[model samples]
Target: MSTPGGQWRNRETFVREGDGIVDLLTCKWAREHEYRLTKEVWAFRENRIAVHFAYEWHDEKGRWFRSCGNENWESDENGLMRRRVASINDLPIDIGASLFHWPQGRLPDDHHPGLSVLGL
Candidate 1:
């Protein structure tokens, strides 16, 4: 599957384990700065979930952007995500208009409204 930063790789080629997924995430995060993400589950069923997510980040040049997307995920019997499909769009935003204001890492649990309530 193609990730947000235009990294296109066949998900099937990678082993369906946490290591491969973590590698991909590490690479993605390494290229992104001040990244913050939020996801809201829209639907869920046995071994499958539908979610809408948004992430905010700034480029090396300090250009800020908000990437929004919807993803559908399928998991194996062990609850490991075996497949994921996502469609995303990026929009530029002024720094002053940015919504995510937490630290540079994982957001805190008390951060309310998330992307959905903020109409991201």
Candidate 2:
């Protein structure tokens, strides 16, 4: 059984799962970042693991965002995560805010704040 990582897979699979959002991101950020995880709170059954974790991501410049909240994983017998569901509110820091933060074209930071603007 193949484990499910955050948007990790071949291009075709990603397109199928991602609803053709036109995302240029490769599989670079697929797996869970271990350093962010504060603890594995509990495991109710062999198939279910409850955990508390801090999740963060860096932009192209390597500036990491504030660690976010916990997420849960429910795996099959093979320990492959078949179902991953998490309710993430929002982190306080806006050091790196996604373009979606605004209404498509209303960002105060030059109307677009991303790699293209920074000229990565």
Candidate 3:
């Protein structure tokens, strides 16, 4: 996968081909109190999809951030993601400025305002 730092691949996993990536995610976000992801837009054609998304979360030190990104996914014949690419940017925000305040985990679609409504 590609990141702002450069191309990335796991060099530490002894099992899962990309388990190092999962490990990083778990270390960074697994215990975050406000980690939430919201989909802003999506486009699909055949085996490929493009997505625009944003998420808000806080680090262990309680510094808040809103991360926005675009991702491209290509699927194989079995409809599994064969390749994934993403570009992301993180912006620090005030702790009370979060737009996502629904109960942690799943956001109930019926009562929630999306990115457009919230003016993200």
Candidate 4:
């Protein structure tokens, strides 16, 4: 999850599948206003995948932010992620400068593939 100061933290246990879902829910709740995310696969081999992602959102006071990150995921035989490590950086952006223009949800298939396409 991300903090108000732009720090990321592993606040939930990943010992069980349910725990991850709960953590996601909690994190979403913590972020306010028009959250949109896009992720692209960077590489993959066997049970591991590397991804790059960017998300745009606003705070309660309508301050906009763009967060970019890279994640490494390791999955079990069932294709469930067993381990995930992420490094992220958040930058404040003006609303007009934001790149994620989709409505507040999943990006459409026709949207740009990743941050590189948008030069984010």
Relative to the true structure, how large is the alpha-carbon lDDT of every model? Answer: 0.74, 0.42, 0.68, 0.71
lDDT per residue for candidate 2 within 49-98, as digits (tens), equals 66654434455554545353445666666776555555443343454552
- Give the TM-score comparing model 1 with the true structure, all chains together: 0.76
TM-score of each: 0.76, 0.41, 0.75, 0.77
C-alpha lDDT (0 to 100) for residue 48 of candidate 1: 81
* Model 1 RMSD vs true structure: 5.6
**Residue 69 lDDT (model 3):** 76
Cα-lDDT of candidate 4: 0.71
Per-residue C-alpha lDDT of model 4 across residues 30-120, encoded as one tens digit per residue: 8757888898899999988999888888988889988888888777676666666677788999999988777767689885556787775
Off by over 4 Å in 3: 1-16, 30-33
Answer with 2 or 4, whichever has the higher TM-score.
4
**lDDT at 104 for candidate 3?**
81
Clashing pairs in 3: none
Ranking by lDDT: 1, 4, 3, 2
Candidate 4 runs further than 4 Å off = 1-21
The candidate scoring highest on lDDT is: 1
TM-score of 2: 0.41
